[model samples]
Structure formats: C-alpha cells, structure tokens
Target: MIEMKEVHLIAKLADLQEVDYHNTLVLHALIELLVEKGLLTHEELTAKAHALDSQLSFQLDLASKLSETIQNRHTQIKPIS
Candidate 1:
C-alpha cells in the first residue's frame, strides 16, 4: 500500500514538473520575442551558449584534476612523531 508520505512526495514531484514546464514556455517566448524584434540573432545565441558550455567543461575538468592532485599529495604526506 502507498503511504501518505509517498503520496505527498508524488504530489511535490508533479508540482515541480508543472513549474519546469511553465519556465520553459516563458524562456521560449522570450527568445522568440528577442529574435522577432531583431535584438539578437539565432546564430549569436547559439555561439554564446556553446562558448559558455565549453568554458564550464574546461573549468570542471581542471577542478577535478586539482582535486585528485590534492588527494594524492595528502596520501603521500608522512606523520611527524
């Protein structure tokens, strides 16, 4: 049998999905208006998004490498008596 807590969680998930759908619709409408008004071009938006994604990926990779280096260094340290 489904518990009351499980029912509440399911309702919350549905609410989140509705909110996400609404936000997506708003974003699409804003993008369409911007393009329609000639304030921005599709190519420009695509290029900027791609650039941002590339930068984020590079930063994440650098952070992962730095974290691994820190862990390795910590493991290599010797304790003082």
Candidate 2:
C-alpha cells in the first residue's frame, strides 16, 4: 500500500509543468516534505528533483508550442462556474 505522502509526491510531480520544475521554491519544498515523511531520502529526493526539473523543461517547451495552437479553449478550472 502506498502512503499518502508518496501518493501526493507523485501527483505533484505530475502536476508540475516543465518550466515550474526548476522553480527551486517549488521543487525544494516538495523534496523537503518527502524527506520529512520518509518517503525519500534527502539525497534521493534531491537527485530525483533535478531529473524531474530537466524533464519538465522539455515538457514545458512542448506545452509552449502547443499553447499557441490552442484557441478558444475552455478551462475546467472555475470559480463558481
């Protein structure tokens, strides 16, 4: 059974776009939390964060290109929609 912390870590990793992955503020916080929860060792978490950061960079590049092609898009995110 996966722990909640592990589940959240994976989900957040997925949620992070490539550009924001390098945002030290974001990744560091996540890594720190994972470490605190014992879901990952400090070294392991740090290394994984770096790898994810690089992967996110590529994903961001692709998203940027695709964003331009998207028009009149409907956002699922809403406030009282």
CA lDDT scores, all candidates in order: 0.99, 0.81
Error of 2 at 29 (Å): 9.5
Question: What global local distance difference test value does model 1 have?
Answer: 0.99
Q: Give the per-residue lDDT digits (tens) of candidate 1, residues 1-79.
A: 9999999999999999999999999999999999999999999999999999999999999999999999999999999
Q: What lDDT does candidate 2 reach at residue 78?
A: 57
lDDT for each residue of candidate 2 in 1-74, tens digit (9 for 90 to 100)? 99999999988888786557669678788878888999999788668879999999999999987885563253
How high is the lDDT of residue 71 in model 2? Answer: 39
For model 1, the superposed segments whose C-alpha errors exceed 4 Å read 1-12
* Model 2 stretches with alpha carbons more than 4 Å out: 1-39, 68-81
Model 1 TM-score, 2 decimals? 0.75
Error of 1 at 13 (Å): 4.0
Range of the 10 consecutive residues with the lowest summed lDDT in candidate 1: 40-49
Q: TM-score, each model? A: 0.75, 0.34
